[model samples]
Target chain A: MEYQDPEDFIRDDSFLLYCSGKAPEATARWEQWLADNPGRRQDVMQARELVLYIQAELTDVAAASATFRQRLSPVSDLPAPVFPLWKKMLGVAAGLLLLAGSFGIWRYISTPDWLEVSTPLGAVKKVALPDGTQMWLNGGTTVKYIRKFRQSRQVVLEEGEVFFNVVHRADVPFEVRLPGGLQVQDIGTAFSVKSRQQISDELLLVQEGKVLLKKNEQHIQTLEKNEGISIEKGTMKTTAVKASPVSTSGWLTGTVALDNRSFSELGIALENTFQKRVIINGEQLKNRSITITFSRQDNLQQLLETLKLVYQITYEISGEQVIIK
Target chain B: MNNLSPEMDVLWERIRHDDAGAVVILYEKHYTDLLTYGIQLSKDLDYSKDLINDIFLHLWEKRRQLKPVANTRAYLFACLRRKFYQQTGNKTQVQYLEDELLQSISAQSIPSQEEMLIAIQHTTEIRQRVQQALSKLTGRQQQLIRMRYYDQLNYEQMEAATGIAVKTIYNTIYNAMKVLSAELKGVPVITLLLFYFEKR
Candidate 1:
C-alpha cells in the first residue's frame, strides 16, 4: 500500500479516531496508512503521546466518592431536621392564632370613647376596661351602650362574636346587652357572645356556659349551652343552636371550624383567621353556602381546592387573592 | 506486539469486562495529576477537579461501549479539556450554587480564595462577552451546548435523557462548538471549562 499524506490522515476524523484508539476498522486502515507513510509514524506517535498526556490528568474518584456519600448519608444516624413538614404546619397555625389574638387586642385599644365598641372582620380584641371586666371581641362584631356599664354591666351586641371572661363581682352583673331588647346576663363563667349583622336583623349564638337574656324590661329567655336566638322586627326568638364549636376562640387549637355559612360569611371567617382582607368578587356567590373545616397549617392550594368543591365555584388564585366565579 | 500504552490497554481490557476495579484503579492513578495540571491551566483547583472528574466518570459509566484507547491518559486529558471548556462557559449554574454553599463555610477556610476570586472576576468578564457571542447561535445549537457541556451530557445518554435522536446530538454539539470557536475567539475557554467541570 502507498503512503497517504500524514496531513490527510490528520484531517480525517478517522485519523483522530485511530490515534485515540476509538475505531476498530481505523486500526487496520491506520497500519496501512502508517506503512504507506512511514515518515508520518512519528506524528502518530506524537499524537498518541499527546492523548496520553491529557488522559493522565482526568480523575473520577472524587465524583464517585461524593455520589456514594450523598446516597448513603440519609440513612446514617445523623440528627434529622427539627423543622419537619408537620412542625412547619404547626408553626404556621400558631402564627395565625397569635395574629388573631393580637388583632383582637388591637381593636380594644383603638376603640373610641363612644356608645359603641366593635371590630372589623378578622379582628380579635381584648377589651380591658377601667372596671377590671374583660371582653374578647370577635371579628365583625360590635357592642354599644348608652351610658357605659354604670347601672349594671350593660352593653348591646350589634354584629360578629365576643367572648366575655367577665370578672364576676356579684354586685355588678356583667351583662352583654343586644339589639331589639336582647340581653345576655353572665353569672360569670367565661362565655362567648356572637351576633352577625346584615342589611336588616341579626343572628346571635352562645358558644359556652349560660347567660340570661331580656328585652324592654321584660324577662325574655336564658340560653344554656349550644343555644342561639335571632332578633328581628323588635322580636327576639330563641332557637336550638347547632352543637358546633365557634372558631372565634379555636385559635388555641390551631383550627377554625366553619359550619354551613354563605360564601360571603365564609369570606369574613377566612379574613379573621388569616388576618387578611378576603373580598368575594361576585354578588351571586354571596349566598352560596359551604361547610369547610380548615387548619391554618393547611396549604393555600388545598384550602382553595376544598372551597372550589364545596361551593361548586371555580376560582383563580394569585398570592392572597382568590377570585371566585 | 501492541504499540498502545500499557495503561490504555489495561483500561480497555478492564472496561470491556465491566470491571469496576479498573475504574477505581484508573481514577486513583490519574486523579491527582490531572487535578494538578487542570488547576494549573485554569488556576482553579475546584474547576480542575470538576473537569477531571467528569471525564473519568463518563469513561467509567460507558466503559463497556467505549472505543479502544491507544493512549487512555491523553484521551482522558482531552476529555477533561473539553469538559473544562464546557464548564467555564457562560451558561454555568454551578458557580452560583458552589459560591452559595462554600461562601459561608469554606470560602474563608479554603486555601484557594485569592485564586478563586481572580478566576471569578475573570470569568464574569468573559461570561458577559460569551453570552453576547453565544446569542448569535441558533436555539438548537445553544440547547445542544447546554446539554452536552453544561449538563455533561454524552451523545447516547443525552438521547436517553431528552428522547432526542442520537445523530442529532452530535450535529447539535458540533454546530455549537463550531459557532463557539468562531465567535468566542480570545475568550478564555479553559477557565470556563474548568468551572463547568467542578459543579455538582
Candidate 2:
C-alpha cells in the first residue's frame, strides 16, 4: 500500500475494516504497516478514531435495538398460523354470523343508543331528525345524536360546521356539543355551530332563538338572536360578536362574508368552503385583517387570486394545502 | 454494502425453511439499522418503529415463499423507502437532506436568540458541537459523506451515479472526514454516539 497522509489512511477500506474490528487480516496488515513506520502511529490512530467516529455517528445500534426488541417482543411471541385458508375463512364467517345475530337481538331490545350523520368535503347535506328538526351540514361536518331523540335532543358536533333549525319543544331542550367540552343548549330556537380542526375557536351563532353556553358544567353565556360567541380551548373567556344573518346562514344561500377578519381567520373560512387546508405562512400576514365577500360557487383559484391582489400577498397551492406567503 | 454475509446467508436459508430461531436472528441483526433509517426517512420515531415492525411481521408471514435476496439490508432499505413515500406522498429531495444537515450546523454556529434561551434551559452542547463540525464540510462533501456512510453506497456505485471519478470521490470523503475529525476532536465519543442514536 502506498500510504501517504492521514487522508490516505482515512480513505483506505482496509484501514476502516481494521478500525471497525471486522477484519483480522486487515488489522494485522495495518499493525505491520504502522510498525514499519513508527512516526505514522499518531496519524494512524487519528484515522482510526475518525473512522470509528463516522460509523458511530451513522447510528446508535444498541439503543435502537433495545427499543426495537421491546416493540418486537410481543409480536414474536404470537403463535404461528396452523389453520388452512378455507378453515380460516369458515371460522371468520361463523364469527361474523354469530356477531350479526347477537347485534340484531341487541338492536331489537335496545333503542339503538346513537345515530351519526356526516358530510364529506365540498359537500353540504340537509338532514331531518326523527323529531322534524332540520339540520344543514356544511362541508366535512359530523353530527352524532342519541337514537332516543324525543326524550333528550342532544347532538355532538364532531367537526366542521352545522346549522340547526330545532322544532319548538318546550318540554325537551336541544343541546349541541362542541369540541373542548363546550355545549350549546338551545331554548326552542335555531342556531349554527362551526368547529373545524384547523381553527382554534369554536363558534356558536344564534339565528332565531336563545341558547345557553356551558363549559365543564359551568354556565358561560346565554346567547340570543343575532348574537354569537367564540370559545377557545382551555380558556374561560368567550368573545362575543354581533352576528349578521349572512354570517350564520349565508352558506346555505351560496354566500360568504368576512368583516375585517385576520388572514388566519380567512384561511379557516376558505378551508371550510373549499375543503382544502389553508396555511398562512408569514406571521405578519397571518394577523393582517381583511374584509371580503365571495360566493360558495367561486373557485379557490379565483378567491386566492383576489386575495393576492387585495392583500398584496402570494400563495402557492401544493396538493391539499394552500400556502399563503 | 454487498449483500448478506455467509453467516447471514445461512440464517436466511434456515428462515426460509420455517426456522423461528433463524427469523429471530435475522430480525435482531437488521432491526436497529432499519429503525434508524426509517426514522430518518419518515421524521416520526413511533411511525418508523411501527413500519419496521410491520415489515418484519410481513417477512415472517411470507417467509416460506420469500425469494433469496443478495443484499438483505439494501432490500429492507428499498422496502422502507417505498412504504414511506407511499404514506407521506413526499418526493424525497436528496438535496434537502444535505441542506437540513448544513442548516443544523449553521444554526448551531450562530445560535438564534431563541436557541440561546433554549440552551440555557437544556444541555445540548454535544449536539451543537457535532452539528457545527458537520457544517464545516461543503455541501457536496456532506452529500458524499452521507451517501457513503448513511446510505452505505460503495465508492464505485457513488462514482457511477455522480459521474465523479472513484479516486476523486475517495479524496473528497477523506478530506471531509479529516475536517469533521478535527472540528469534533475534543468531543466525547460517547456523547457523539448518544446524540446520533437519540436523533434516529
Candidate 3:
C-alpha cells in the first residue's frame, strides 16, 4: 500500500503497531518504507506522533482493574449454598443485630474519643459538627473532634486547611488546635486555618467576630473580622497582617485566591488543591510573589496557561510532577 | 475471534458445572474489565464496583442455567452496559465519567512534593480535548471505538455484540481516529503520551 500523506499513515494499523513498538514486522515494514521514501519522513513522524497520542488517550485500566479484582474476588470465593426460608430469615435477623452492634462500637470508637474527617487531594469536604458548626475541610486536610463535641467543643486541624462557621454559644467556646503548639479559641466567629505540609507557619484568617490565638496555653493575640495572623512554628511569634475580608475558603466554591503570596506558597496551595506536585525550580522564582484568583473548573491546563502568561514561566509535567522553569 | 482464552473457556465450563473455584477464576479474570466498562457507563467507581460484584453473584446463582459463551468478555461487557444504561437512563451523561475517573485515580495517591508538583503540571486539557474529540464522533463511531480500544474487543467480537459488520467497524474506527487526530491537533500530545507510557 502506498501512503499518500500523514493522515494516510496515521490511519494504518501497521503504522500504529510500529508506533506502539508492538509489532516487529510492522516496525521493519515502516523502517523500509521510510528508507524507500525519504521525503515522507516528516509525514511518518507526524503519523507516529499521532499514533502515540491516540495510545495515550486510552485509559490506564491496570490500577483500577486490579482494585476491582481484589474487591470482586471475595464475593466469588464464597459459596452460595441453598438455604431454607426460615434459615435465611434467621440469618437476616442475625446480620441486622451484628450491624447494629458494629454501629454501636463504631460510634463509641469515633465519638467522645475522636472523630476524624479527611478530604483527599483537590477535594473540599463540608461537614457539620455535632454542635451544628459547619466545617469545610480543604484538600489533604483532616479535622478531628471529640464525640461529645457539643459539650467539649474542641477540634484539631492536623494538616492542611479548614474553614469554620461556628454555631455561637456563649456558654461553650469553640476551640481549634493547630500543629506545632498553636491554638485558636473562637469567640463566636467564622474563621479559616491553614497549615501546609513542611511549612513552619500556620495562618489564621478570621472572617467574622473574633478569635483568641494561643501558643502552648499562653495567649498570643486576639484577631477580629478581616484580620489575619501567622504563627511561627517554634517561637510561636504572631505576625498580624491587615487584609480585606476575602473568603479564602474558595475551594468550597471551586475557586482559590492567592493574595500577594510567593510562588512557594502558591505551589503548596496548588499541590493541595490538585493533589499534585507543583515544583518551583529556582529560588528566585519560588519567592516571586504574585496575586491571582482562579477557579478549579478551569482545570490545571488553563491554570498553567494563566500562570505562564502572568509569570513568563514554562513548565514540564512528568508522572505526577510539574517542574516549573 | 473468541474473547475467551483456553484457560477462560475451561474456567467457564467448570463454573457452569458448579465449580466454585472456577467462579473465582472467572471473576478474577473479568472483574477489572467489567468494572472499567461499568465506571465508564455509570460514572461512579464505587457504584461500578458494587454493580460488578452483584453481576458476578447473579451469574454464580444462575450458573447451572448459564449457556456456554464463546466470548465471555463481550458477554460481560454487554451485561454491564445493559445494566448501567438501565440504571442511568441516559447515555449522554458519559462525558463526566472520564474526569471523575481521573480525579478518583489522583485522589488514590498521596504524592510526595516532587510527585505532586509533576501532577499539577500535567494538564487536564488533554483529557478534555480527548473528550471533545470523542463527542464529535457519531454515536456508532464512538461505540465502535469504545469496543475496539476501551473494551479491547476484536472486530468480529464487536460485530457479534453490536451487529455492525466487521468491515464497517474498521472503517468507522479509521474515520473516528482521523477526526480525533485532527481535533486533538496543536495539543501537546507527544509530551503527555510520553508521560503516560512512562507511568505505565
Best by TM-score: 3
lDDT of 1 by residue, A1-325 (tens): 2223222222343444444332334545776866987777555543332222222222235544444332222212122323356334433443454455633323221122334566776555555343434566766777765445444666667676666544444677777765555667776444555556532334445544566766665667777656665455345444444533443345323355555556776676677777665677777678665676665556766787876786676767667666667
lDDT of 3 by residue, A92-160 (tens): 443454445532111111333776666666666556565546687877777788876646799998888
Candidate 2 lDDT, A221-291, residue by residue in tens: 89998899877756746788767666776665456666655787788677767878888987788778788
DockQ of each: 0.04, 0.05, 0.08
User: DockQ rank, highest first?
Assistant: 3, 2, 1
Worst 10 residues of 1 chain B by lDDT: B100-109
Candidate with more favorable, higher TM-score: 1 or 2: 2
Poorest stretch of ten by lDDT in candidate 1 chain A: A70-79
List, residue by residue over B89-132, the lDDT tens digit for candidate 1. 33232321233223322222232333443433443454455566
Q: Which residue ranges in model 1 land beyond 4 Å of their true spot?
A: A1-120, A141-151, A198-201, A230-238, A245-248, A251-254, A281-284, B1-200
After superposition, candidate 2 runs with Cα above 4 Å error: A1-111, A260-262, A271-279, A282-288, A299-302, A317-321, B1-200
Cα deviation at B52, candidate 2, in Å, is 52
After aligning candidate 1 to the native by TM-score, how far in Å is the CA of B60 from where it should be?
Answer: 80
Worst 10 residues of 3 chain B by lDDT: B100-109
What is the Cα-based TM-score of model 2? 0.39
